[model samples]
Target: MIHPILDDNAADALVALLAVREAGGVPLVGDSRWSTQYWSAVSSHAKAECVGGDKAWASFSSGSSGAPRVILRSASSWQVSFAAVTDLLALTADDVVYVPAPLASSLTLFSVAHSRSVGASILLPSRPSSSAEHLTRATVVHTTPQSLRAIVEVIEGGAPHSMRVALVGGDHLDHALRRRCAALGIRVIGYYGAAELSFVAVDDDGLGLRPFPGVQTRIVGGELWARSAYLASGYLEDGGGPFRVDGEGWGTVGDRAENDASGRLMLRGRIDGAILTSSATVIPDEVEAALRSIDGIDDAAVFGLPNERTGALVAALVQFSPGSSRPSTARLREQAAARLPLTHIPRRWFWTEDMPRTSTGKAARSQIRLCALEKKARRLD
Candidate 1:
């Protein structure tokens, strides 16, 4: 059974998932909002090449980059760690779970499965909330930092809320967002994971993230590798999208990470997102981190665009808070130079009130590049 995220209500999705599981049928979930261009890019891989057991459930994912893929996994893949995951959140039947993302997303789907295992009630995304009254009963929320930022921007009540914990992922979250969530009486738990490999690690420690109890991890040649019982079966209709399996049943999705002095995992961002400049290779996330650290900048995404002189020139799109004093492009360049390497500084800058985000609330870098090349948006310089 294939289910699109935008097709039906949360209740209907839940019922479909349960029905598939009970009937020993594979249930695949897909995002319905993909543009024609995105579909065209992956149509070559969408032929009748279905693999995996009838009992396995599949979900479409991009595996961090490039074209989308259908990932296959048996119920035990996630069920094996459900108890440990809930125990980490201290979730119980009394807790009301909330996931602001669509039901077909891996994070939201895993949250649904976990909540169902623990017998907790869930509030899926309804229309955008103008007030916090709809969230009065929510105790725990699973969302990305972008979606949470959108909620905080329009929400009205500053009164103390009932939310206790938040499972945040999908992108790199800065300390400012964490502070904002703290002010709202919610504790933020940042995690690093991929659809191919479920929950790799969580920021249970203040320094970074410690691996889960049953999870195993190692940093090999700067890429994070995992050996866990929750590993998904290989991608369908494709050789192996950005992942490799070893003889020991360990898997790696090629994400760059490192261990801090305290043995906690610290992500360095995607290995494929590095831009080859004329002078040096620059990782966009590194430049983006520096940009967001400056005051008045709420979000940032750095990319490389074609240049006549250099093979590629660094460009950036930044988001600023409404009514906040926008800094000049020269001022931003100076501040960025102090932190980032000279070659990493953005050569062209564009400003937008809102950053481009995908259905999963992740920064849409491909779209940002298109917008930058078009030169249609407001340029800070």
Candidate 2:
């Protein structure tokens, strides 16, 4: 039986405690927002509950649409993730690792664990908003594209610090952002994985991720399928049962990918709800990456909409950078043509203050697609 500790005041701490519970251990969670009551509650519970082995489970929220789903993974998976990270970062015992994301996030959890695994010191700022302070002390940092951008802002504003590496994932890493980080002497490594499947591909320590240890990837039907011991058991409540593993122990997470002739894995997008354009198929991520490279654009989301002539027309919902206005549709078209094929150029551009993101901060592709469809419908009406 699972008895999760609830701390309404601290969501990350609460989730971390629950994960500790789920992995066959007990957690003494308390309200960090309040002092005396919180510590007392935690102490009482810890004294009463049985102390178990180090192996434990933790839950994290994940989804592209609908309510977030809770994913459970073992502490061992975190160890594996950390091992890969330490290998990729070339972390040393004396290194200081910084985590800006919440501890409940798999990214942050594993990053911290990875640092600990290598005997490296961890420097977590008490506040999430203190990017500059955290960046100043750490040798390596883990961040999403958005967070990395914030770090870039700090550095550009004359923050004095140098990082050995900045690992960017949780979203597509644009070449523009990569170039900026590169100029700062911070090598940006893009990793691709989900809570359901942890650390599928990590940039191969300057060589590019050539399949990490204990993981295998294959391109089946233009979709990327993976088999790894590190894959989660399955989702809670959904009872989807265990991931389908082959006799050899390979499992898939339903991501679409392409392999270069040299066998490097390039992720396309998800298999479900992929865009089928008039001239050719459009992978939203591929197009989104292209769109993000255009000057004056901060970020973009690419998806498809119904069209009488083209089955589904490609469209982009974009947020231009500050002090920048929407580009002329013609110029936008030219920019896309420079990197993408004619079929992949978005037929229409919709400007928004910001692209909507999921609870986990991933670009909500499903929501953006729905918004595009609704606007298209309004036009028809």
Candidate 3:
């Protein structure tokens, strides 16, 4: 089977995907938005053996943890969950599912597959629009939090929202965003998942995520491990980084989480995304969450900046809404100090008009750090 190089063309990509699936060929999909380094990783996975005797989909990791790599997902891995996705979204032939992310991305790719399996019409990625007319027949919207944020504002203060279900993924759904979506009558459900692990847990009630049905999750060494039918095949150039499968067939993606008393999974952050300072190991997501909680700040990214003393310094890059007055760094440090340990409080601060994010809305940490460092990010102390 000839593998197709999918790019910005959705119709061509869809046709190519259909051809590959019909021919039982695992189409290797790479995001055109990715750096050449990302493509190199996908090239490495082209050598991996297609484990099952069925059609499969080869995708690259989101690199939110660290460096991106290729992952081979069997057709059954998605096909087995088709009905679940359909039922979860309450999709029908009359329903039109809208996903504006690129077809190359796993979120949009799986969404494209899900809509087709359920016989639902799809609105593929195109010129960005917030017009209510475009969302007229949109019953279900599968998108990232970044994209959804842009969309909800378009629904007006009390618009007759046509969208019913909002299937969000690719990043953590903030608390305020969840409430805002609910206020608009859009039931937003976010899934915590990875390319290597299709669907691990889902948060529907704005509390926390629970292991998906038929998915068994356990906290191992402060990291989340799972055994599910939808798990992906082994990586091609897996240097044994975070992709590990125990002898019992449980695989973890290096995500750290704690289990609450009621057994709901509380995500701390990724084990790979932590910053080791002189006094404490700071999780950027935790600090970023705190930053987002602050007034006037719209989005934030926290990363470790190289420092001669602490080996690394906690740095924050922030984005605020237009017309909002910028908060002083001293004020920020004071606010963060109340909620975080001294070590967790940012030692430096940078501001960007918008966050550095990938096509799927996940933070591009490396790019973000580069952007801030280029600006000579201000130091707090």
Candidate 4:
């Protein structure tokens, strides 16, 4: 039996999850706000593919690179990590965790389970926009940077809050966001992982990402691979996907990374997202990170467009900070050149007030590229 989560009622969702666990039925958590056609396709596919008594539950991938898929995993896979993450976060029954993200998100679902495992209460808002009322009651927040930024904006507007620590994931945490959290007196703990790979590495302080507890990570051919019991079993219908598992029980989602001087994992980006232009490869995450570090730039999404001379040309969709005017192309180029290589510099540019984001709050580069091709986005160059 596949249970679909259509509402945002935290109590109902938790009760359903517990019932499914007791009944030994697979739960397919879904968002009702999704298109009916999309939900129908997913539910039908899940019903046909989701078999096996051991399959505990299913959730969608981040889909930042492409369309999301349904992933199935056992209960122990997540139950084991609950203890690890709970201990890492120093969570206790006295804590009240707030998660504003939708239930379809694995990150939010995991946080709910983790909180319940430690006997901690949860404060899940009916709508993400209605989270301000519960903010003052929450001791810990499990959120993405996008959601956390909104919380910061709310706090800046004179709303009272009692959040002490936040477990931020799903996207990169910039220094500006960190500063805002610091001003609010909230300790930000950023982590790097995937839906399929679970917890691979974690950044405790401002230091860097080390291997997550019970997980061993290694760089293999520029991709980070890990061996951990927290990994999901596999996708429901996997023909071609980034997820890979080796004979030695090591798995990787094709994320490129290297070890820094401190022996911590330094993520470059996903290998599949590398852009091929003029016989050179450009990692969009590296370029976007560079662009975001520049003053007056709020966020960025980098991609490649088809070019006649070069195989493809590097392009970028930039979101400027509030109160900052869009800079000239030459000025933008000059700033990019200081931080990026010639091939990495974007030849095409576009600007939007708000950058497109995946459901999990990741920069939707593919969607940005599609908008550029369709002439829906305002092109600057």
Candidate 5:
């Protein structure tokens, strides 16, 4: 019988504990103001399920990737991942780790696990905006790229914070954001993973690349496949998805990837959203990233359009930076081409005050694509 932890004290923590318990190990639940009452409920459930040799289980809220599915992770899996992160960051017991993301997030839980494994002190921000304040006394800061952007904005606005190591994840880190962090004398380490899997790759340096250890990655037919000890066994309900391994035991997340001659992995985009053009394939993420780097563009979403000749043509919908003047279409197209190949250059552009975003703060590419296509159809009509 699967006992789901309802205690709110970092629901993800409860999920992790559940996984540990299922693996026949004892797990500890920590008290947090956000989910104190919830933790008590889960603690009671754990007691009811207690058997002589049964393991303790923890539950945590996995953000937005899948439906609310609880992951059953072994205690060894947590320990191994924590140890790997500690070694990657050179974290010590004396270091002060600051976590700005919600405790329920896998990223924050990983930080907490790393701290517990090393006897380090962890400081969680009371609110998202208070992260800069917490960073003042923090040696190591773990946060999402979005939160890190906010923190850097605060710092640039005269907030006082000294950071030794900055771990950036949750979303892809753009080149523009990385350069801003570098200017602050802060070393940014980019790691890639999802709630379904632990961190599979991390880049400790500023080389714009991610590498993996204790993990095996291969690109099959342009899709990136991986096998690692950190991956969860399977989803709770569906019990099947991309996590399924082949005979070789490698699993894929359906992300298309390209590797440089130096063997560094560069994510092209999700295969689900790939646009096929007559001349080549178009990955929306690559084009969107390029447009976002252009001056005066605040955000961008690139998608495909039906074309008589090209099968599909690229289009971009963008939000301009606040108070920045918009560039001419020709100028914007030229700028995009300078950073991308001709095929990658967006053939159409639509300017908007803002683009819709998911609750997790990622651009709603599907919605934006629909809007762009509708606008084009209306014009033709």
Candidate 6:
């Protein structure tokens, strides 16, 4: 039987997971807020796969690029990483970890499991209103960059509390965000990983992403492939999602990466997500990072728009920092030109007061592209 989890309590969910694991059954941990129809579809898909299989757990992907799908993995996959993280973070029974994200998120589920493994206490918000209260008591926090920003805003200038460390994932943690958290006495530990390949690299001191313990990485044609015990079995779907396992036991989720001069793995986004514009390939991640580095720019989402002349033209939707006056498009263009190549520079510019993001706090590239094509977003030029 599949254990469909709707409970938000971390302790209760831990107990249920332990029980389900002991019973040798698959547990489907999902968010209760998912639409009934969507939940039914995901559960039905998982149940079909769980019948007569070695799968130990089932969860949904973040669906940042597309619809969420059922992913299956052995219990040992997470169990091994739980021990790694517990040791890496030096978690103890006395520690209180706050996980504000829903149970459906693999990041939160992994945090809860890791906390339980180390005999640490976990604080999960019963409602949106309880997040701040939980943060006040937490010795550690596990959340996305977007959620962390909201948290920083909530507790700004307040007397420091018990929270000291934040384990951030699901999006890039910008320098400004990290500095803000540091001002609040909370150290951020940003990591790069996927639900399919657990814990590929970690950045503890903001140097860069080094390989996580027990994981070996290699860049194949600019695509990163990892070999580790933490890899998931496969997806429950027929095609098995984008996860691919080689004959040599290496698995990859099609993430693009390169080794810097320091040998640290630098992510360049996904292989399939690259935009083909004017016969030149452009990685939106590279452009977006450049835009974010500009003065007064808070965030950026780069995408491709269909163009009869260029086949596809690079476009960008940006958000400026709060209290900063909006600069002219020409000024913004000059700033981008200095930082990016001609092909990487955005041809079309748009602005958004509130940027659209996935549940995991990732830039919703597909959503933004759709909005721009539909003329729903405010065209800046």
Q: For model 2, what is the error of residue 130's alpha carbon versus the real structure, in angstroms, after optimal superposition?
A: 5.4
Ranking by lDDT: 4, 6, 3, 1, 2, 5
What TM-score does model 1 achieve against the real structure? 0.89
Candidate 4's TM-score = 0.95
Per-model clash counts, in order, read 0, 7, 0, 0, 21, 0
- Over 1-381, each residue of candidate 1 has an lDDT whose tens digit, in order, gives 332223246666667776867776666654546665654444334334455463366676643345557777778999998988888789999999888876667787788788989999988754323247546778888888887776555443454357788888888766777877777767888887788888888885445788876889998899889999888887766464776889998888878888888888888777877888897988888888888888888889888899877889999999987689888988999999988888999998999888877656677787788777887767885
Task: Please provide, for model 2 over 192-236, each residue's C-alpha lDDT reduced to its tens digit, 9 standing for 90 to 100.
Answer: 877778778877344445676677888778867687768765544
Positional deviation of residue 51's Cα in model 2 after best superposition, in angstroms: 18
Residue 190's lDDT in candidate 4: 86
Query: Candidate 6 regions off by >4 Å?
Result: 6-23, 32-34, 51-53, 127-131
- The window of 10 residues in a row where model 2 has the poorest summed lDDT is 26-35
Tell me model 3's lDDT, rounded to 2 decimals.
Answer: 0.78
Candidate 3 residue-wise lDDT, 1-381, digit = tens: 326365657777778877887777777666666677756655564644444565478766776646666666777888787777776777898888888777767887788788888788888755434557657768889989888888887775444558888999888788878888888888998888877788888887787899886689999789999998888876655376577788888988888899999889888888878898887889988898888888888888889888998889898888878798887899888888888888898878888786777667888887778766786554333
Better of 4 and 5 by TM-score: 4
Better of 1 and 4 by TM-score: 4
TM-score of every model versus the real structure: 0.89, 0.78, 0.90, 0.95, 0.73, 0.91
Q: RMSDs, each prediction?
A: 2.8, 6.4, 2.7, 1.8, 6.4, 2.5
| Model 5 Cα shift for residue 321 (angstroms) | 2.8
What's model 1's lDDT at 214?
A: 83
Tens digits of lDDT, candidate 4, 144-239: 888888899899889999888989888888777888988999988888989998888888787888998899999989999999999998888859
Best by lDDT: 4
Better of 3 and 4 by TM-score: 4
